[model samples]
Target: MRVHHLAALVLACCTPAAWALESFVVKDIRVEGIQRTEAGTVFSYLPVKVGDTLDDETAAAAIKALYATGFFKDVRLEADNGVLLVVVEERPAIAQITIVGAKEFEKDKLKEGLKQAGLAESRIFDRSLLEKAEQELKQQYLSRGKYGVKITTTTTPLDRNRVGINFNVDEGRTAKIRRINIVGNENFKEKELLDVMVLRTPGLLTWFTKEDQYSKQKLAADLESLRSFYLNRGYLEFNIESTQVSITADMQDIYITINIVEGNQYTVSDIKLAGDLLLPEEELRKLVKLAPGDVFAREKLTESVKLITDRLGDDGYAFANVNASPHLDPEKREVAFTFFIDPGRRVYVRRINITGNARTRDEVIRREMRQFEGGWYSTSKINQSKLRIDRLNYFTAVNVETPAVPDATDQIDVHVEVKEKATGAVMFGAGYSNMEGLILSGSVAQDNIFGTGKFVNLMVNTGRVNKTYSLSYTDPYFTSDGITGGFDIYKRVLNTSALSSVSTFNTDTTGGGVRLGIPLNENDSIMAGLGLENTKLDLGPNSPQRNIDFVNEFGRSTINIPATLSWRRDGRDSAIWTTSGTTQRVFLEAGLPGGDLTYYKVDYQLKWYFPLTSLFTLMLNGELGYGDGYNGKSLPFFKNFFAGGNTSVRGYNISSLGPRDANNRTLGGNKRVVGSIEILFPMPGMKNDRSVRLSAFLDGGTVFGPGGTRPELEGFRYSTGIAVTWISPMGPLKVSVAQPINNNPGDNLQRFQFQFGQQF
Candidate 1:
């Protein structure tokens, strides 16, 4: 087609402009070349219209404006005999926009967020959109405290007349809190003030939790907390004057300085109450645990306020606010305190709302919530529910919010959001101890079983001298009253050749039991259970003749009904990384009269975890077991206690530390006590995931009979060893090489003993 003909044809199809008539002045002006655009949109751009003169400059300006809309590519103005024409070529509509180099964010989310800045996928490409995207990217980084980030945008025109956009971002080094300096502090030292602040030095753990990274938002919060700290303590005029943050010359470190003006410290001069109370004023005053002539303490005052409000709440005043205001006397540096209370209308919780639980069932959260619909609002119960959810270990984060419903003045709805985490795990572990060589154990378990707060576990133990199989289930909350229940089934075979035995015997055991757990209090519980067992004995070739006579006198193939009562108290900081606490368990088991075994066993175990510092932890474990038989007999030798091995004192052979015979084989005893001390610290140059650890341990113990006629004190043995543990993908693998520190006569000192998947 000819160029002019094609142009004329395009003009004919689009809006037609007014033609110049001979001797006719242009009375009106309009735009032609308008496609996919409203005629009014074109008219709105024209500087001249009806009854106004139409010149070439005016026509050009109108055409330019129309093209600037990013809707056109060609613009021209034609004037014939003072009649002007505005002609333009419309741009093609964007068919698609493809984005690349978006790894930090999802493509769809970035696309949607870009649309808010006039960069929709189907819209025509423009340089302005790229500029806007760069700004948005920088803003996103700034929100996350990444001030050193760099963002670049590249635009490419595609074959289909569409544009491809790429946003290349360089998230530079994180700005960490290098130093926090507090100035103008008289009462407290710099170290003390720094301890009060949450921002801390970047230590070995900084990379894991990222808490040492500096953020203006967090610093602002810390400053506010500091202000409250002084103000609550009767420093009413205390104020933070300025906070300055400066970056180092290398832009790698950040230094923060906070300047504060601490006002006069005051003592309590008088106390008064200004509130309507259902009880006498004296009673209300007593609830506030503050008195005249006492030094000003913000924490105590805050607690006192809460106490008054809680007291009112218990009397059906659910919406009560208590504020303690201190009036300072600057001359005497004394303050007079007044308690102000406001009791709003009593209201009940109409309903509780739950949200953000994308996968978990609603009942899972609801079951843990102590608050109920139609019940009086209890802040304590709500807080307790939050704690319970946190303890579930099924969620990384849980939050509960109460937003008042619109048009419902006295009613509020609660919203709970939970982010789920992986709680089910399968672990296969093996370890070598001086006691049990090449021990293998594993567990396949679910912590949150069937979306309920319960546990189910299956375990297996395969060791040189011990083999065990067990299945267990526990319901943490068997009833609404916080009681728990558990059941276990196990079968084990144990060999005692390494043990210092009074007799040469091995035992094969199969048992199953059920337990009922009752909660005596929040931190204390009691458990009682009955187990049925069948025990078989195999006398070794070198069995003591007298011991064999005692066993034959006692009989084999015994049926035992062992019932035990146990108590445990745990106060460790972390179960795996404890710095300080004690765990003690005591139990007593007595076989029933109907069973073939007629004996009573008492056992006690005590464990202490002491955290010396951020890098060191010490653990001590001790155990004592004593058993006696009644009715003219003794406890079976197969069921006796033995010590020494990886779990026991490390340097000696398995069960080799106790009393031994001339042949170096273990002779079972009626009483035993074992004690071990282990020092655990981070493996040098390793992370805190505790994937690997190095430890040194000392173990000492002995086994003796009721008459104490077996081994002499000079023959008592002990062992010491170094251990290495790896928390690998399969499970925990441990290897220890121990040597006997003290050896008895005929004792075979184990030069090296190793194990995997065990802890001692």
Candidate 2:
């Protein structure tokens, strides 16, 4: 058998002038030159049937149609004794694909890229598709500044009419930024403008920050930052004209040039509101935190507009739009801003849909939502709902979308999507302190038990001087009205060997308590609890006299029932990393009248965070406590409070502050006052890093016993220190160093202390 080229055969069969074709009736259809395709497939694609009269036009149409299927590389039609024969060469299937020398990208990722270009394993083999995939792979490497990357493809034929493709890749090194030039800036210095951008030339910290590597995305973002910097600094007409990036022959060095236009600086001459003020003009005017005669800052102008819009959003105006139009006077370098507000229709929530929570119940997420179905949409409530869900710590991410309902202008649907996280944790922690030596702990906790929003924890810990075992549980919505109920049972043993300032004795305490929290408002809450405990004291020959006297007067073993009442107000923007907020608490705990001892304790704490700048925060914390036994009895030796620890005055030893006993041992005090001021900032060379913090702090505190007068004020211990806190994957780690400012004789001091978990 002789096989002719399909293209020449088709051309000969279709041309009447060349082939001299005559109309003929086909009696049977036969397909030849097919290796893998079915004969029926060829017959089905033929436009003319077996008995239909066929002409040159019909034969050409049939041949063209068969080639259009992309299943055949060539197609030809022939006639023999009034019968038509269709010949097709099937495209070979790809048996396998292998990629070599692809170190910059994963083999699977490259395979996926090829697959997207229709050249994967078991797919039809096409030379054009392979070339396309090669070009795309090169482009991908080029985007990473790899200008010297090279890719080559090879195909090998295998048995059973299949072909294997191999891609050889050479991914060169990423080009490093050598120089960055900024032009056409007259007001701000080049260094000042470059300081605000993310992209930079090679520097000392380039290895960790990667700022020396050029990226299109990073360059774009840096350009925007440059624009914002000028716009916020009274350059109202700042513009980025062009950005050019050039690379060396070796693909090792990159140089970038950014051309910008900075117009004249302008000061605000007048500011007015031009839109319909839903609220009184006076009230809306008060929301504008900017004034005339101030520098025309686009950021401040936009912020004022947002404030007014948010104020309206709180009043059920969900679809409000505000625009600030500025009128410029190039001659006087002055500008006037007028805010135009458009309050669209007040939309009501038609439905509230919760999705993407595979493990957690719908009610668990719904309970945290402030917005409700069939209610007027409030932007504040919706945002609060999202924040509340985030604070639950049950989900890794929560997103809320308000999509307007179709054909309903005044109605919308609220969609809350949540990505659930692992709510159960097996925690193991270890730490070392100057006083505690080596401490180890382990716990099993579940924040969302069985997806019902209940919390349970079981913990056992052992340290050099302390051991504890505890079980705890909580139901945040005990009454379905945001009431919190919880209980904790624990057995703890404390050994005071390292804490030499305290008595060298051991105490065993076994206790359990039930507590309830009532929400008074969004930021205020009241908590009350009742507890019963049995405490036994063991005294050594080296015990302090205060401990021995307490044991002699009140027996070594005692049982008491204590009641506690507390009120707390929290206004922090964030619970973990608060920038601005104030938190205050007042607490009181008293022994019942029928208890083994009669005592009452009171304490007050205030914490305020003031944002000094966008990257710095000033935190102030103060605590004061007073406790005494009623009916002329002194405060229990074990019930007294002591200062000086990582959480207290950092320059002193734990429980090592206050007056000494007859044996020169620390005697715990009945009154305590402690205060600290910290200036918090992000770690150096870390951009937008929230997991770690560095702070400079000043700590002052003292403890006073009944034997001392004005000791808390006169004998104040002072310390200044630097501290660091890191939220590691395993847990949180804190370290501090301090120097005593008013060190006294016989005072126990711990200048440096640190706690390390498995994570940090």
Candidate 3:
């Protein structure tokens, strides 16, 4: 067979003037010069079929239609005695793709990205698609401040009508910000304005924070911060005129210039409310936490608008809108704000749909919903329901959406979506603590047993000084009203002879307990428990007098029915990663008359977290404990409270803070106090990761017994330290480095302490 160039055939087929042509009736159509393309595919794209009339107009149309399919580089037509022939040169397919010198992203990830952009292996190759892939690779590097990156693309022809594509990337040094200039600012100093920005020049901390790197997103956010800073300080008309960011010729350094207009400071002269006040006018006025003749602050204005809108939402007006129109007087530099309220239709929840729960039952999630079907849509209740569901910790994520029902103005449907996570674990573990030399432990736990929102755990632990065995179960919804019930049985053995701080003695205790949790409100709860335990004490020859006296007073073997009551209020945004909120707990435990002893211990603790900035938080914690015996008996020596430990006072030895005996060992105290202040932030390079955190803390604590010669406040010690907490694969880990600020003579010291699971 002889193949002729299609260019000449197309030229002769379309032009009737170049060659003589006569219209003929086609008998059949045949495809030629196709290696990879099928003969049927050519016929499908052809406009004319077998037995159709063939002329200059029909032949030109057929030739043009074949080229439009993009399956061939050229197309032509030939007529052989009332038969038409179609020839097509198919485009080559991509056989393989290779990416090299890509250190920032995985090769497979880069290839996947190219696949989405329409250039990948086994796909027909096009020059335009190849160019697009190159730009995408460059754009990804540009996002990481790599301005000096170079990308080269190569295409090689291979056998079997296929081609190979390669992308070679050169990722150069990342650009850094050398200086930042603020122009046209009069009211605020340059240093103050720079302090508020996330982008900055090279500094001591910039190496870890990477704030010195140039990023378009960071610059835009910094400009917005400047506008907000001025507006909140009475600069009502502040504006960012322009921002100019320039890079060095070598693309290694960046300079940013921001020009801002600081308008005159304005004061509020009057305020008014207008338009459709569904609630009482006086009632809405009280919601405004601003006053007349105050500085015109945008922050305050935004708050007032939100208050009114949220109040309306609570009243079932889910689509309410509150707009503030400001009246300005240039001469007096005063502005008056008028709030316009528009309460849309009062909507009701028509249906509640739950989805995305594979292992969990629908009833388990529905029970946590405060918003129900056929109920008026309340924003507060919906928000509370989300929080309650999150607190269950049975799912990785939970989301709710309220979409308006079609053809209904006063009805909507609530859609709840949840992503479930594994809630069961079986672990074999070993840990080491500074006080306990070596510890071995094992546990099996299930937080959502059978998707019914029940909890069960079995644990066994052994150490040089302490050993424990326990089994526990809990039903979060023991009743329909959200009451919690649980029970546990345990046996524990403790020996202080190996410890240097406390008196040398040993105790073996066995017990079982039942507990109940009653919710007083959304943030307040009361917990009560009762249990019976038997303890047998063994005294060593080196025991302190207090321990010996306790054994003589109340026999070596004693039994007690312990009763506990507690109240707690937790308002944190997250129980696991608490960044803001206040928590208070008051706990009391008593040994009742049914057993051999009668004593009571009460503990009070308060913890507060205040956000200092977007990236930092200040936390304060304080605890006080007191214990005493009833019926004129002394507090049990085994039950005394001692303060110093890694969990209490970091720089001091475990249980070392109290009055000492003749052997210079802690005899234990009846009263104790512990307080600490900490600055908390995410660890470097892990700002968005919540599983790890760092803190700088100052701790102070001491214990005092009735026999103490010194005043209650005299024996207090103080320390300062840095601590880190990380959730590792084995278990939770904590490490601290501390320096004792003030320590009395003979007080034990342990400067570095850490606890983490390890295998022996």
Candidate 4:
């Protein structure tokens, strides 16, 4: 009898007994067992309301409707004294989420993932959704080669019908690739195929590059590269059969295998151009890269199509399409290609929209864009505008989008977006040198002050041998015509008493200058400046005759007005780590007739870079300077040139490589020459990084005194070294290790040199 009553209650929850309940009309509806949910919510979901007959189908429909709301765990219905009672047990809401022992991923990132999977705070909890979230968390670790990662979720019930979900994670060690095998390669060797893949077995550089770890994304890219290799090698029907990745029981080792099929080789038998050829057939035919009797190269075929399309775009056809169709002869092992050209209607830009420049003024960026509003669309010009904005160095990134205007087939909008970067810096640095002992410096500068496109800087340097202070300001576009203007004020103090090979002397100089730069063309500019300086020379007891003579003849101090003119042309792809470009400058400085000393100096510098390969660049640099006195006045010793340092030669002490006095003290020279050749490459373990650079260089340079004081030919020095430059978080750092190839006796050698916090 008890079992029969329990079965009747179960049946009553799912459906009512219509024969017994149809006679009873529901007088009122009441809800029970709901802690957070309102009674009206239950009443709204009930199909049979007050004053309506309660039947089996109506009761079943009401239960189904409440369950579909996803807010309840259980629902029950009962009839008592002609009244209906609806009861619901609400699911607990998530009050808090905590992740413990997470290192590889950030806590916020994990929480965000959980939120996307419907397990966030204040959301009704579901056990099935929690299981999916856990599986997803494990998969993320698996993608990073952490096969042994373990995750456990526990819910702690709280007051107000809420629970806290805690995810305890144990991220195990990354699995290392133990072996990689390439199968079914007939023409190519296994080693050849593996060489092109980024993933490799554990090696010397594996820790930094992480190339020994298995990644699905990296594997996909590697497969595509493999396919391209065979297709470019005349295997026209190459395909990847399968790839398998397996891990060991302990999750410490991984093995990958790739199976591929390389079909028969094919050669090009003929190539033709079909369809609408808006230009002359001869003109378009010349752009094709493939020829008869050549191996079928997929890369060349793709390039030919792009070239044809670009040519059409140059002539105001922005929507041109060029397709290549190949006709294959299986038995003959030959292929014929026909390129179909479709030159669509010429489109114009309806508008050019600039956005994302919250700090920089609109005019500051608009002046760099080459694409104009309401102009004929040119792909090259639009692309050039993007590159120009990128080169400004004020923005971290620049992006462009072309969206066709709705209901206007002949017009499109060019949307440009830019992300600004911090252009101001404050730096303090210290370094140790064998000769100078220790040096300290500091600077504060802003390249784009308040987004006005102006520059300002203040610098101070205090060293054992050299001390300087300077302030400068520049207006890049000073006038409406794009002229550049700037002013500088400086004070310098140089003491040579601590040098082993230089005369013991001290000099103080104070000067100020104003300059204007005029642009002649995109790559060329002319700069002119005028300055007045007062220099005081103090000669020690053991000072050289050259210094003593200049001080005795010109008095303790002298004033001079100097005028300078310079022409420069720069075409480098990047100011730092340039790979291809030519830069040249010619500078001339002369003292005016009113000055106590009348002298003139000429300088020339040229630098060129050639990209020898995709990964290697060859660079050449040369500099020459010559100075002489005019109107029977001698060139001031304070203005003489000195060499043998970071900016001149790398293997000798600063300014310690010139003519020597009776005390073996170096005397400044009037002429200087320098040249260097270097091969630049990426640093190890950072194949595509641009912020750091490494190079092997050979440098040769010398300085010569005036008249009969010039040294012998052996005085010229040569050095070979390796150099590294890194744009670290603090600032730019440069380090070089060099050995003098032709070190004569008495030549001061400095084998290693380095500096940090260098200005840009």
Candidate 5:
């Protein structure tokens, strides 16, 4: 019975083996269910070869590897006649990609930027990367004021395992500041305080600087500046209560409200002093510039304390401490100030340390410093040195500090840091004006020559009837004591017009001069020069017989000596946009014994700028000129003054503002006076940076008799015009179209002039 049972078990096992043999071993591989994938590609993933054994284990492994390619949605593997077969269904390929709701950035630019983040067109798509890209793009727009924007993407399957994606965008309106309110001011009106803030209403130029548009960060900064302004002025109790920013119901505008508590205004009622007295009390008082009755200006008070400390240090008190305190009177709204001083120890300069001059040589900065190592310290010299460094133009900022040694309080280390900026410029320009039509001018100047503290300029002026070429060089420290010297060589040609029987004449002049400039004070200087000139005069037919006769009498070989004295005071807030200040210059030029000509010429110019608001500025300019000759000779034709054109009266032709000949041609004016007033604002759509400026200007002036007659008001031509100025990449481009307001008989109404490259 046991033998029979064993036989039954063996037969049962043998029977299962016989059944498995009925399934044939694979002889060849064939893959099915592949839409866009090749049979060979699927076969490559299989671990079994044609000659190897195939089973469910190996077939399952092959299916998993095929699916891992990320190109298949489903994979299958089977075996027939001992041959292994695999099948794959590829995932769709991206056929297109589209993005919507982007405005601050271009669609193509954003797409290109996203390619680096692993989201690109015409490839397998990943939803995870797409989501990241969408968030990034939205943040970019939000940073630029596009707060309400939406992005949507769509995908569509294409033929042959390919798909297309579309991203639809809806860019909402931009958020703009509607208003800014400042609270807590009693001494100054709200409008006055707002005027002090940099941010203001949007205007024609808001697009450029974007300053008119408000940002939360910028508003916060402006508020902080306001706080500092009041605090520095003795408003010790000034505080900002709250600030609120609200969006309008339409969601298109924003309004900002600020509340402040302005404390009492303080005034100086008494002044007292303590500590060391390096100078007499009277002398110290004179230098303080602060008085008991004056308003308690914190900035001025600090400056006074610094001045006292500096005075003590200059007198061998290197470690001097000066402190100022104000005791307020609540009833009188005034304060009594006291100054305390301490002379700790007399010190010398041990060493001078210089830093931040990466591009400039150390000697360049060292040469301008007044304080030296191993020498007695003088605060006055140190301050003067800082000013000199600033004037170099090579450094955008200069800072000087003196720190005393801990153990040796008598000694100090001087440190100066300089931030560099571009100091060389090459400019070229062309323009058309009534005075000098078809004008071409260019200049190459280096304020800091080759990293040295010097200046060089090459300039050219080419006009329809005149041309000038000049080369000049200046050494600011020619004498090592702040004396400046310059040398210039120039050539000029001028063609004059004739009226009625008076003929036309042409003059060619070449000259060279050496000038020495001496500084009289911080804001004043005196200059004198000697020049040698050679001139040639050519007369046309029908010319004045007397003038032609005079040129022939003098042989046209006139030598001229020109001497000039000038004074200027400039305290403008900014050169491009000035709000308040007065700039004045008076120049006098007289002929001396060295030259063949004898004449005196004088000119005076004054310009004042007033700020009406953050967006509006007013500029007034006035000029007066006079020239007269001695020895019965008229001033050289080249020396005569002429007015009109872009820089003068725009409604008139160039050089046509003064007087006219019988033929209606301009006869150069001899004595001239001109005055102009302009109201400047930003151009529409360009408020940022004030890159484009628009102005309404009124101009009036005239040129009078050749000798002694002064210009008369009755003869002055008056005009009003609209002027546009573009702060272009090259320079300032000015275009003005003017209409004569009070026209005489036969006077033209319209005149157009433009300057391609000019500062003002």
Candidate 6:
């Protein structure tokens, strides 16, 4: 009788009758209406036991637990003679997900994004999750300046209680920035302030550069740039008050407004240092670039701090900290600064770890590291080591991090990560040049062979003007002391009949040479080699008198034992695009004993890149060449120096700047002088792209000394021109346009010249 009353009291778990029910023992719990979910799975989620007393609270708890699992859409309880019956209606599982009209991103990518939001295929479908996924998708489009995008989702019920979801998307056009206004600018013009920002109104290059696209990240960066511009120019109290961004109704145009407060400019009243005197106070004071009455520029202060810390780092204080404290006088518009230095404990390298070099041996990278294990940890050494590894060119990237060892304050581990690139090439290609005609070429070269730091190359080329076959090998670590050794063998044939501008001659040369490199220091090296070459000359009737004289004296064919020595100091920051370093090279080639002709030639060249501003670079170059014969032998006419081309004296013809023979033909001179001054900048719309460079140059060169020094060296042909260099997908491309200055009547002036080569 009591069981019947309990069963009757609970019509359903959520009913009011169940709330008034009395406690009763549970006999058996059965779960029904679960198709895809297992009966055992339903039992695991039941919170009540068979022997426990069941009441309104336990029944409600059971329903809440089942619903929380997200596997059921509806859950209820039924009572029958003290037996508990739990019924669940399972949610439909997603069988498949499809996307349509997704052109901005791949369909798989969109599905992946939905998966992150818990709305993937073969998962229990939830309307809330679907809503969240749609919002996330919209955010992605918005980030790309797409203010007008539409997404519609559909649900299709499939067999076996599964459903399919389809999302239709329409990616609209990108919004462009139409107006940018800077308010409250007192000292600088609005245009002047806008010029420093990355975001701008539409311009001629906006289509390619995409700067007209409004982006939140770019706007933030522009604000920071504005802050830096003011802070670096003595406006210590500059502040950006607010910014407003708006889009048009059609979502095609955007407007940005920035409000700023440019406070009083401050000058340095006095400067002082308050820190540990690890170095002499006078030296540290000298490192401070600011003086009394100097404008208070934040950049100057920051630079001073960095210099102090770097100086400390050189002495093994790898974690040195330098900070500045400023004192402001509002009335006088003056500020004073005090630099505080803290020299951290001297640390030594505990171990050097290498990673990410799957093919290259660790020793190849280790050999380039200047910082060794179990040595004093010098920051400069660590930086230099990374630079050296990057300069290897075998790896695409090299990175280093000094992580402190656990429980070891005085020791740190240097972790070097490198990304290896393809260092070998098998090439078969054809190229054409205006001067050299069609050329067929093939090469098998490896800069890093078999996980070893060695180089080997075999090359063959056939062209109208030249043919070459060569093989070479080099082991950079030939000796334990960083000495390098290499050997080369080559046969070259040259035919200059097509080169009407250059002096006419032809030769078939065969030679083999062995060389060694001795490292003078980290940035300097000396290369010495001895070669044996045999040359067979072919001179036509139109050849210069000097070529005739050479064939007559050397009997049409001659053997030469040439000794070559070259000293190079390369301190440039980059070999490809240098900006602020000096490079100097001196080379000497002399005929040694056991040679048919005894002669010597020397060339010296210097290049300096001085950064005049952040965007402008001043480059100065000088080259001098002198060659003559010894032991009563005239200099080899074929060995003479030739100038005047894209490389030197841009307005003149190729190898056309020099003395003339008795027949009034262009004969190359034994002496040459070339100097150039240039201002280089990035190409338009390609800021900081190292592969392309543009420059305005002043070039001057003269070749002389075929007859006498005074008469031959009298005139130095000069030209002012604009040139561009691009490390294009093919090869190095150079174009120049020049106008000659102080023209001579018979000069060969070429106003424009361009050279491009293809490699495969």
TM-score per model over all chains: 0.66, 0.83, 0.89, 0.83, 0.66, 0.82
Q: Once model 5 is optimally superposed onto the true structure by TM-score, how far is the C-alpha of residue 381 displaced, in angstroms?
A: 4.1
In the order shown, what is each candidate's alpha-carbon RMSD?
A: 9.1, 4.9, 3.9, 4.9, 11.2, 5.6
Per-residue C-alpha lDDT of model 5 across residues 1-760, encoded as one tens digit per residue: 1111223323434574532322335677777667756767666766666665544344445555666766677665444445545545566767777775565678789888778777787666666777887787777666566667677777787777777777676768777776888766678788878866766766665666566665767788889878867876767668899988787765567778889988977777898887676668887787575798876776788789888888887776777888887687888888887787777777889988889987777877888777788988888888877876775657657889888877875788998988776566665554444334454556677777777768888777665466778899998778877788999999988665422211267778899999888877665677778788888888766454444666876776677778777776665554445577778888888777656777888888899999886678899999999988777666765576777667777786556555444434444545889999999888654556546788999998877654222133226788899999876766557789888777575332237767664321
Give me candidate 5's TM-score against the actual structure.
Answer: 0.66
Predicted structure with the largest lDDT when compared to the true one: 3
TM-score of 4: 0.83
Selected candidate, larger TM-score, 3 vs 4:
3
Better of 1 and 3 by lDDT: 3
> Best by TM-score, which number?
3
- Structure candidate 2, residue pairs in collision: none
lDDT of 3 by residue, 7-34 (tens): 6446666664676446789898888888
Better of 4 and 5 by lDDT: 4
Model 3: pairs clashing at backbone N, Cα or C within 3 Å: none
lDDT of 4 at 600: 90
User: What lDDT tens digits, residue by residue, belong to model 2 across residues 1-760?
Assistant: 2233445556666564666456788898888888877877777877889789877677778878887777788777767777677877888889999998888778899889889989888787888888899999898887766878888888999997899988888887878888899999898899998898888887787876677878889999999889889888899888889999998878899999999999888999988897778899899888886788898777888889888888887776778899888889999999988889888788889999999898889999899889999898888899888877877877656789999999989898999998776777766554345545554556678889999999998777676567888999999899999999999999988877655666678889999999999999777889999999998989878876667787898899988788999999988876656799899999999887777878999999999999997788999999999999997666777788889878899888777777666555666788999999999998866748777999999999988885432243336889998999886676557788899898876677788777754421
Off by over 4 Å in 6: 1-129, 155-167, 426-442, 498-504, 575-577, 612-621, 643-667, 673-760
Which 10 residues in a row give candidate 6 its minimum summed lDDT? 1-10
Q: Give the least accurate 10-residue stretch of model 3, judged by summed lDDT.
A: 1-10
lDDT of 1 at 657: 52
